[model samples]
Target: MTPDRHRLHDHLLDPSGGLVYHLRALRHRHGRWAPFHRVLAGWLAGWQPGRRELVIVGPSAGYGLPTGFLARFGRVTALEPDPLARWLLARRPDAGRLGFDRLDCLAGTDGLARLAAAHPQAAILFSNVLGQLPAPGGDWRPLLARHLAGHAWASYHDVISTTTAPKPDCAGLGVSDDGSLEAVLARFWPGGTLPLTDHDTFRLGGERPRRYAVWQIARRRWHLVEWADNTGAAPHG
Candidate 1:
């Protein structure tokens, strides 16, 4: 699966700029939020923290992560093909440890190899990025499988409604009857049930906050050794 060469990507290549949010800030508190950042931290907490290699995919704008979360790794590498986002990331503090590489996994499998080659152990953090990277015929299992074959992998993204856009009042992201993930997981694990778990349902903006309360749902932790232990989406509307 390479980068989506469609019109959306064309908008990302231009050397423009934008602010990158911490991502965790979106959790619904009194009313609105999608605290993906907090959810990811909790899931990752189950595993070893201090390690050597951690690769971040599609780090748009920079705040895809911070030196604090990455303190465990000796060095962190980010694969972002968008010059606009990369340019913004360069200005971030601790930029030295956060190496930059315009790796377009959307282009092909080579980029995946480059990431997998990380020494010791390599974990992938698809922090709010993958869903945007057009999947081949709308399937993301292959990529997840490959990454899982290496080290622990995690993904956080917007769970768009298959039928229509989200409503204004819906605050939490629960597992609907939509076999959104099951269908994809089946492609790799065959009869395996997708390891999904519910994340925090928080209200952002305090009381009478900005938007609806958002719920974070993600996969259970799994890494590569024991068939792998591993691991969205909203762009603030």
Candidate 2:
């Protein structure tokens, strides 16, 4: 998959910006990203699907993901389009634990459907990708709800972000899933004086329980991350 045609973006950055993101992740994986990674790992541990096969969409180098989590599946497929990221992911610690498969899910409208058709028993995951999608064509929540209806699925993506948003209280490990984005933001960034840009991911989760966390993706930019799992749910029409 070519960079412009099918490569994924690195949230507000172009497809080529993935390299920069990878560098930043390597620099901050144990420093700035420590708190968020801890919370993410805990959240991942909570996801227990019955299927042995798994599909991870847009996981760039598996930086924020724990290797132990990926090893839980008997078979793991990474539906990534970035060539560089695919290479880096293969070298991650204990990469040998997973039986990997690669595909470009962003290549066409039916990519997701086709994946489901090909691996009907596999559980699907959107790994911090939904929020980074370019507007107009980036809205895949509806398609996901429609196409992967019968399968177990989970995702954690940006709900909103701003260069002025304050740092989150990562003193804890659990996410607060009590209210709307406004309420959650108020709890996370109380006394915020600047307006926030909604990532349009708020419409997801569809009344299901959602967990919220704060991520300082950059020194000045902060993202309110949201996670949800739709397991054992009926197919959407």
Candidate 3:
């Protein structure tokens, strides 16, 4: 397998690497992740792309993805790095509709464009992996907007994370780039503030309305997950 070039730090490596996230999912999918799964499913259900093929990047074990959702596409390929996740993701009930790819599509300067060229008819999805990736001089968003201009795409990723539990009401909130990260964090943690990590995803959605949710990935760690879709929009040039 090709080495990943995204340069994620150890703390941010767990999910993309697979083992840690798989183990956590086994323990929390039915508990902590239940609400998130529901919200994510609802968000996904609203997306109806014209293509029947789907290419999901970094969908670790697909714990947050619903089998019914996978069934929506005639062909679903998972571009993941974690061996364990690839193994588990393939065995999903809708395994018949799924395939695996070894390409590290985010590994090089033109990787995304290359991937787009390779699967011109497939809808691309950045599955909860964006927040875990380093910003590469804070150019990630622009890079995506530019390269994926003519494709049907969507992404659900982390925007902010903290040890403190955010308000449950923050789930399903619509986030915008106009607000300060501090303002967004304040709404989620109205009781008080705590040390946090901004996942550099705050404005990935631009002024687009994004579905937001809180994910308690661990007992003490929580993440602000944001979802955006462009399946219905005309391709941006």
Candidate 4:
């Protein structure tokens, strides 16, 4: 990362980052949130697929790239926790090659179970939303395990700062925290690990620094299953 990029990341990860992101999301005045989306999309690019079903939880301003790109390959079921954001997605013009679905925020284990059932065989993308959950009791592993069923793939992004520690081992799956998605995936899935191939980065346009770490992940098992070919309504662009 360049000095500029690092600076940007620092600001975004700052405690006040939520305020900054929320303000930009509220305004939609410019591409204030575009950099974050771009970096996330870059990470998804690594998991190239002929076709696959995807589930994106916490769809904020828009379905970020790579997820947008994956829409071309298969269907996408987007779950947004914020009502305002969901309303915006519902109103936005279909960009073609992409589909959108709005779900009530997954508040607890039951909610996660329902979400997992709704999009079986889909790759689940959870980005930046985990930290917002009430900590200590927030057990996402059940949700992850539910989605990981049927040879599915799931990608999660969590900000690493001076605080917060890596999660403990789960089900023999290794966990590693690097600023890169490749390193995370390798830690999650070893041996037949694919190369770290896709990435994108974005920097805040202003003087204040902010950065985002994006990642794309896929499970080898999912490749063996058949995927649906049709995606839902395309947003009119």
Q: Tell me, by lDDT, which candidate is best.
A: 3
Cα lDDT tens digits, model 3, 1-237, are 333553312222464555677678888889977877888887788877777889998888788888677888899988876767777788888778998776666755667776787777789889988888775456567767777767888999898888887776764454443466666667667755477888888767566666666777889998888787665345333
- lDDT: worst 10-residue window of model 2: 8-17
**lDDT of each residue in 35-115, candidate 2, tens digit only:** 888899888888887777788888877888886777787778886656677788788765665544544565577666666
lDDT of each: 0.42, 0.73, 0.74, 0.40
Off by over 4 Å in 2: 1-17, 97-102, 107-109, 135-138, 167-173, 233-237
Winner by lDDT between candidate 3 and candidate 1:
3
Identify the superior model by TM-score, candidate 2 or candidate 4. Answer: 2
Candidate 3 displacement at residue 230 in angstroms:
2.2
Best model per TM-score: 3
lDDT per residue as tens, model 4, 1-237 = 213311212122333123354564555423433443454444456444323666666645464543345445456666654544545555545434345554433454555555555665555655445544542235544444443344334343343221111223322122223234334443434445343322121110112122233222111111100011122222222
Off by over 4 Å in 4: 1-22, 25-37, 49-51, 66-70, 90-105, 161-237
C-alpha RMSD by candidate, in order: 13.1, 4.3, 4.0, 15.9
Candidates in descending lDDT order = 3, 2, 1, 4
| Clashes per candidate, residues 3 or more apart or on different chains | 38, 0, 0, 10
* TM-score against truth, every candidate: 0.52, 0.84, 0.85, 0.48
**Model 3 steric clash pairs:** none
Candidate 2: which pairs clash? none
